[model samples]
Target: MAKTYKDVKIPEELFFNIKNFIEKYSELGFRSVSEFVNSSARNEMERIEDRKRNE
Candidate 1:
């Protein structure tokens, strides 16, 4: 499936943390910090939707 991504800006500190994590754990299969953040954002979105549905 083709992904339609939306660009969003986050705080520099948070971005730095993500980059730090990417360097600390390179074996997680994430090629870049953006990919790692995108994957984590998708999971958080799903969790939010699930909780909303339950409510």
Candidate 2:
């Protein structure tokens, strides 16, 4: 099955910041800003879920 995706917009300044961070730390293995953002979003979702479960 094909995976579906959607666009999520962020402030332009924050986007540039992530771009710069990824460029500076190329060895971290993030291929693009979108990849980093996706990973960060997923991590945050898990963290929030865990916190709620513990409470």
- TM-score of every candidate: 0.72, 0.89
- The superposed Cα distance between candidate 2 and the true structure at residue 34, in angstroms, equals 0.6
What is the C-alpha local distance difference test score of each model? 0.89, 0.97
Pairing residues by index, what is the TM-score of model 2?
A: 0.89
Q: Per-residue lDDT tens digits of candidate 1, residues 10-34?
A: 8999989989888898888888878
Candidate 2: regions farther than 4 A off: none
- Provide the RMSD of all predictions against the true structure, rounded to 1 decimal: 2.5, 0.9
lDDT of 2 by residue, 1-55 (tens): 9999999999999999999999999999999999999999999999999999999
TM-score of 1: 0.72
In candidate 2, list every pair of residues with a backbone clash.
Answer: none
Clashing pairs in 1: none
Measured by TM-score, the strongest candidate is: 2
